[model samples]
Target: MRYVLGIDGGGSKTVCILMNDARQVIGRSEAGSSNYQSIGIAATLKSIQSAICSAVTSTVKIEAICLGLAGVGRAADIENVKVLVQELQNSQLLPIIWDLQPSNIVICNDALIALVGGVGHDVGIVAAVGTGSIIFGRNHQGKTKRVGGWGYILGDEGSAYKIAIAGLQAALKSYDGREISTSLVENFKQHLSLASIEDLIEVIYRQGWKVKEIAALAPIVDLAAASGDEVANKIIDNAAEELIKATSTVINAIFSQNSGLEVITTGSVWRGSSKIHERFTASIINEFPHAKVIFPRFEPAYGAGLLALQRLTR
Candidate 1:
């Protein structure tokens, strides 16, 4: 009769999954961003708490709650979130009663759950690319390693943000006679309704365009590539190579065996038909002939539930 709650809190949304001890899913709910770094502690807690309450009935007793969240990589972040969860538990706003001690509430970075969700196990690599990019993996021996999650400023080499930035730069360069002429220049102008290159500065900086806004331009680059723009194709091709390199590094560091490696691609950028996803898949397969690239079997929230179950058993 025991149940566990798993929450995956990302930059934009929070998802909670309720699962029974028999591994059957009971309820699933979603809320807004629960990233404490961006939304602050109170709002983050509110989002997570709301998702949990909506997921299960009031009579259900949760044996454990596992939260895999963005912006929780540091130990201090974990401690802070733990304190917030405790406060929420004592607030009595949640529908179900928490049966276990404070230790039963497991908290970790979201990448770990994405790894588990993608491969359906504790061992494998997850190369998740979105507004930001990170590669996390765990080996069969329980050893783990991570690479290339340095965020937008210093890293995020193969992310949507990166792709969009590169496209913008190329468009500007082409306009300034510094790079090869491509359709991206016209695409940018048409997409953003800019009359000239001069307006781009005002639109991006003066208009307060940020990471997400700039990232929205990535599809323009994709369009240009689809139309046989060599410059755009090169940009996507290079991005794919960077992601492959990061994935290969994690695989080499964690799994030394020459056999097939289970590598999962998660996030919006990897989904559906995109030049980046296609190139990344081909490049990774070329590098590791036995590599099996797959999508996540369950969303990361369910993976967080799996982690909660593991916490109770451990």
Candidate 2:
């Protein structure tokens, strides 16, 4: 039976899935970050190679392979990944042999795979909010549009990082009496084990907290909101509104207002206890009533596998 490999590589981790012609997943494995922009090309290649090596268990020929990676939107980034794939094919270190055609090697941004995996198809919207955020959409006509995804400093409006940052800012504001009283101050102090809220300055800057590390604190805001903290709830509301706006933009661009489509929410931000998902879903449905909001039907690696399988037919 013909087999294919699908790889979902991101800033945090890389996952590989081996599947047969019937779309049955046979092997799966994971490795470290493969986003070349964040971890460099060498490390990205190493992670992709490691995941692929660990996933393939038998001598079945891989007909095609799709690598859906983060930070791979630009043409230069795509070419770089192509070179990495070529290097993998040439290397004898893998347990299996390689004779993949160039056309069968699919490379795309992680957002595309997320959309595909979220709804089990390519034509939908994906509002992905993790350490960062990006909105991507594709329609039946093959047209596409994207919003946000500029990273933390520029955009990522409705992301975990943004939520965490807003929570921290609200805490500081409460501390200085600049804003209404909020439990965020105590929550941050307790969550981070800080003696005082001012200690957050050292933890955020002096202690070298990364974006992901800071994003991990978003649950504090979510929990506070769930417990009836007005400031925290406002933060959650703002995040949901921003995502709604971005999703609306995508829907208008490539889809009809009444088009029946799926708007899949992916990543950590949607997992918050603050009912952000319900808020987002309600807003999207109010604006585009036919749009269906959903969680992922399958992991991104599975979508990558589907894309790889599609290459054979194309």
Question: lDDT at 36 for candidate 1?
Answer: 90
| Model 2 agreement with the true structure over 172-286: per-residue lDDT tens digits | 9999999999999988888889999999999999999998899899999999999999999999999999999999999999999877999889998898888999999988899
Q: Find the candidate with the highest TM-score and give its number.
A: 2
| TM-scores, each model vs. reference | 0.96, 0.98
Displacement of residue 114 (Cα, Å) in model 2 is: 0.6
Extract clashing residue pairs from model 2. none
Candidate whose lDDT is highest: 2
Could you tell me which residue pairs clash in candidate 1? none
Candidate 1's residue-wise lDDT over 1-314, tens digit each? Answer: 78999899998999999998777789999999998998899999899888888887666888898899998988899899888878867877777776877778888999999988777767888999888999999887889899989999999988889988999999899989999898988899999999996689999999999999998788888778878898988888888889999998988787764767788888766752346777888878887887888888888888888888887777
- The C-alpha lDDT values of all candidates are 0.86, 0.92
